[model samples]
Target chain A: MTRTEATRTGLDLAPDARVGIIAGGGSLPVEIARALARQGKSPFVVMTAGEVDRISDFDDYEQVTLRLEDVGSLLPTLKKHHVTHLVTAGHITRRPRLSAMRLNLGLLAWVPSLLVGVTQGDDTVLKLFVRRIERSGIKVVGAHEIVPELVAAEGVLTKAAPRKSDWRDIDAAHAAAKAIGALDIGQAAVAVGGRAIALEGVEGTDGLLERTRQLRGHGRLAGRTRGVLVKCAKPGQELRADLPSIGPQTVEAAHAAGLAGIAVEAGRSLILEGPTVVARANALGLFVVGLPAAEPAHGK
Target chain B: MTRTEATRTGLDLAPDARVGIIAGGGSLPVEIARALARQGKSPFVVMTAGEVDRISDFDDYEQVTLRLEDVGSLLPTLKKHHVTHLVTAGHITRRPRLSAMRLNLGLLAWVPSLLVGVTQGDDTVLKLFVRRIERSGIKVVGAHEIVPELVAAEGVLTKAAPRKSDWRDIDAAHAAAKAIGALDIGQAAVAVGGRAIALEGVEGTDGLLERTRQLRGHGRLAGRTRGVLVKCAKPGQELRADLPSIGPQTVEAAHAAGLAGIAVEAGRSLILEGPTVVARANALGLFVVGLPAAEPAHGK
Candidate 1:
């Protein structure tokens, strides 16, 4: 359906429906806003400062831009917009310097808990945030509710399947990555010749790939044979927020790093711009395997 | 026992019996040679180049110095010296620089396998080497066999016990260390406030500790809470060779890094100059736990 037709269907608002979008950094929020409009809901958007910009495209949306610590203002803003159903979307890039945050009264009370939870992993932080919001009488929905097609699925997504040996490396990488993730460190690990070469840390995936490439250049990487990059969710990871996601950029990075294959937790991950990602991976002869969260095969 | 009495005992070996001491870098080899002299066993030392200097003490004894890849020459030297049982000791300070090694005929056949195994973990590379030695009819014995008292036993070695919370960080560090070890990357990990801060790589323990201290200076580490350092053997490690070892120097490094606790795998790990190391750690209020390989527990 056309964008105009979807918006027209949502022109008449339902009496009790209340939707609030906690927009972070990305295009996901815009997509969610469009979806809400199609369902006769003009969602209220709470855009985080330094995280989100541009809200003029939303047909009937009211936007409030504030810092992460401005929960007191956020609650009142949601109340003012008659929002009862709250949803959070997009990336929240970590700002290690916390002194700059302008925490309000509500967030001030949460500072200690938030600090502890933040070190526990992204899922823990998101869950804690959700709990705080719920305690404020708001029900939270999954980000995928507005864009269900974005969720990844199980099986080989690329044209070429990983070789048996490459599968072993993938399985090893997955286990290592999960262990690393459990420590709230990073989300990706590169396994070459059944050994972990580099782990993703605060530097993010691009940096991790670059490090892998450098190691390869130095002949330190045993990637004379095929290697695998595995991304998986930590045990007890929250699915609604911060599920490990990969995009076209990730494919380009993997190809440049000479990775033979990539494996990600299926259903629990997002394949942003899936078609472009798969096309790039295929062009570079890289295999992309989507693994189910349950009964994840020891790909080897 | 007195040197003369020890020499009189059956522990003293006949001059004809070949004993290969695969000497690495350190004063341990010199000390070991003196101990062997007291027992009347003049070992045939094979010292790695850039690892040990002055095989002068072995002038009266059979000795040969070579690179790590001189397996071909090693077999002939051992055979010529009538070397039957072999003991490897001391520290090999240099990491394997794949590009620099000049492999001989015998090593060339094993180089590929060794490379693949090294990436898998230290044990694999050590085991592959051990297998080659065995095939050439040499018996590989534990380095601690020369000084049985150096093998650490399971329990708290220091007067100080880790605080309850610090123990959690120790446990996490131990697990992290083992995971890195399994990857054949490194043998040490430092964790503070339940987060891993540093991992050992191609660098030795001292370098690892120094790097960690620098990172801690970045103000991101647990404030005022000293971290725990854990060292252990890789998973499925070969017990007879390349066991994780600690010494008085390790304790000094730990103190310099402001570490609160140290954990090493019991029985499988060697404690060079154990009394001095423990005395220093205890004086510094650092808990030194000699943990059993089977019953994995946090330092607490």
Candidate 2:
């Protein structure tokens, strides 16, 4: 659907329809909740334990904080609130601690699948996790369905565009990031000069930026701020959840790391607080752009 | 050549052939010099500036200290000593300051190629570098020619062989290291659990090991000392110079980083101070093995 159609005001839902949100840590979840409420749909918000930051004025909302292992309780809570749609947003660092989990009638059925996800990478785990949620009768939807503007649009979103010399590094970052993502190793990579200097491991994007800073301090990087950070959706990623995300804080991190700009895959990544991200990047003289989506490749 | 045929060595040259050694750094240069002298051929040693540690006991030896930029003078020095074969050993970090350079006739003539090399990656630059030397009519040979035992033999070299669980990490590292080397980005990579976590950049192998340790410390690694470090030649490398070299120091570094083993490509990489390296790894309970060469791929 066109973005305008996706963002049209009013509910296309049944009169009694209520949305259910499995909020992971990040501002995106809060934004999604507020957007849904602005349209007069009082969504049920279930905050993931230890993952989310503080949510303000949440007393009236039908929500509870639960650890990842306590995920089975989410269905009954949604069912209690009569939720028909489910959306999960933000990030979960890794597999939850099984010891702290409280498995219930809902989770006991998916024990085998959860075990399989533990052995696989985060992408596979989230894929299976979301699939299990879908099997519970409530339809799964992407946060972009609620906030279409969060999906990055094509082209530069900042006043500070990449310089001519930065294009090679930009393209290099794009290709390298995709190659690593194909292995499910990472979704972001930093390219300096003409080659990729760092790949994100399980430490995630912020860790990658910090590592790049360390490499630069060691004279490993060329003596300039000509590098770019490229983030994209992993090939065969569970699109309904775990999409690559960046916020204003990511802009500050990129600027601090001496990167020239940030490039995220258009239409496949979340740009949380989009205007502020662009404005902050522009103030710091860094570009924020959205490139075309990544193509699939067979895993080696 | 078969492994045995390659190791069966004696000087395969005319009786008048005098070897010239382009020694860079490390004990390998001094060791190579001593071996050649024992065989009755005192090779002319050109010590690259600021690279070699200490070449003690060299009062009677014929050697000259030359800055990397003074590379132009090497040909004339070889002519003066009647040197017939030239071999560059040890490590030359990068080009020297142009201002400190005293360019000789040959180096001045190859300024264009050197500039082109400067613009490209190490593999391209090294290829053109050896070509320039060969064009000057001096036959270039591998350091392994003088020290055939340096070439790593197949299979485990230490008392500790990789366990079945370690093989997956080894293979993962081998494939990941080669993939990065294919891009001329690095020669080594570290794999933990089943995925590659750190790839060598210009920071080299020690830096790669340190980065892996940091990732592990940050809980990015699987919960165990099961990672392996893999080193190999870049596909289509100019093998006469810059073969990947690991030494006793590498064993200590691997042990310190809490890895299970180290793997180098058989028939291609150099095992500096081989016996000592094996002994140290055995004492540290770490395995050191030479993996077979990487196979080619036609897949895109």
Candidate 3:
């Protein structure tokens, strides 16, 4: 749906429909909660026990902390508040340890799947976890559904536009990022001198940029600049959960890596604190562009 | 040719064919030099001004040092010594600085290509550099030509062979390595839980493994082990230069990264100091295997 349509219909839910924000660490969850509160639809916040660091952000709303092991209590708590929809946000740095889990009635059935999923990659574990939640009846919605403006807009977002050489690096990095994404590996890549110089793996975007910085005077990229960082959703990825994102911190990382700019897939990526991100990019003399949706690579 | 046939023919060059070793920084060049010397072919060594760390290794042979900027002098020096065959070994680490160059008459003609190639990737620079030498009547040969036994042998080389799960990781990492190689990026990748976990960038294999080590308790790889590191020649790569290689250092890196094993392409990859590498792998309880040459990825 178009941005306007999504914004309009997103808030048109039944007055009795309650939303539950399964907040993890990061400002994203607080932003989503604040947006919902502005619409007179204050979400019942459910923060993971060890993951969430700040408690005061949800002081104005009804919130509860639950251990990941006690995920069994999640649905019942949401059900108690008559929650009809759920929104998941932020990062879970490590997979839940199986040994620490004290399986309750709601979690017992998931024991087998959890055992298997815990041994897999993040995407697989997340897919199974979300699937379990959806099977219980409440609908899972993306944060963008609640705040359409959070979705990155197409075209350059910062005052500094990408130069011709920067555009070439962007294209190379985009292709490399997409290639790895196809394999369910990562969503980010960096290109220098019109060739891919780095690919993100499980280490994530921060690690990728730090590595690019370390390679500055090394072979292939010596004395090279005007490189670009490209981030996009993995091919056929679950949008409600892990959409690739950039924020003010990302702008700083890009600048530190000596990159000319950052480009993220428009409409498919999240630009958290969009104004702040753009302002930082502008101040640092780095371009921040949102790429138009690309055609499926395999179809090409 | 078979390994035995290659060894025989490698040493069966014309009696008047004077060999040249363009030694860089590594044990591989020293190993190749010793192998050639053993065959009664005392090679004339050409060392890059800053690359070679040990002059004593070539003390028994005729040698000269030339700056990469004065590549023009390379051909003249080789011709002065009547050098007919050339083998490049080890690493240059960084691209030559253009500002340091003082273009002589011969180098003056190569200004355009050098200007362009210097701004490109390592493969491009190496290709242009070698092509220029070939144009000057010197035949470029692989280090493997001088020491065919240096080529990795097929099957498990270490006492510890890979488990079934480790083999799965090897397959996944091999595909990833080949995919990146097709882009002329790098030749190594790591896989864990049957998924590509890390890819080698300009930071190279050591950096790749270090990154993997850092990611041990992170999202996807939390408590995960039995990962494998895969290295192979790039698709349609210039075999005479930069064939993927692994030595005792690689074994230690893989072990430190908690990888179960390493697999390198047999017949196409170098196993420097093979005995020491195998012994180290065995002591560390990590498998080191040589996979037979693979069919072109596109042909599949």
Candidate number of the best TM-score? 3
Residue-level lDDT of model 2, residues A45-101, one tens digit each, is 888876777566455578888777777777777788788988888776545556656
Q: What TM-score, to 2 decimals, does candidate 1 have?
A: 0.73
| Candidate 1 per-residue lDDT over residues B185-285, each given as its tens digit | 67788877676766664445776676566555553342436778898877766766777878888888887888887888886677776777788887888
If you assessed candidate 2 against the hidden native complex, which CAPRI class would it receive? Answer: acceptable
2 or 3: which has the higher DockQ? 3
DockQ, every prediction: 0.17, 0.32, 0.55
lDDT of every model, 2 decimals = 0.69, 0.75, 0.81
Ranking by lDDT: 3, 2, 1
Rank all candidate structures by their TM-score, best first, as comma-separated numbers: 3, 2, 1
Interface RMSD of each: 5.1, 3.1, 2.5
User: What is the TM-score of each predicted model, taking all chains together?
Assistant: 0.73, 0.87, 0.92
- Estimate, for each residue in A1-300, the C-alpha lDDT of model 3 and write its tens digit: 113333342445688887899888778888888888877888999988777766688899899888777776788898898899998888766666666778679778677667666445556666776778788888888877777778887898878898988887888889889888887788999998888989999888888988888888685565677799999987777777787888888899989989989999887888888778877888999999889877431110
| lDDT of candidate 2 over B40-84, digit per residue (tens) | 787888888777775664444799888777778878888888888
Off by over 4 Å in 2: A1-15, A55-60, A71-81, A97-108, A217-225, A294-300, B1-11, B25-27, B54-61, B72-81, B95-108, B112-115, B220-225, B295-300
Query: What DockQ would candidate 2 receive versus the native complex?
Result: 0.32
lDDT of 3 by residue, B1-300 (tens): 114334442556788888899888878889888888877788999988888887798899999988877876777789999999998998777666677778688778677677666445566666776788788898888877778887887898878888988887888899889888887788999999888889998888988998888888785465576799999988877777787898889989989989999999887898887878877888999988889887431110
| Ten-residue region with minimum lDDT total, candidate 3 chain B | B1-10
Chain B TM-score, all predictions listed: 0.84, 0.91, 0.92
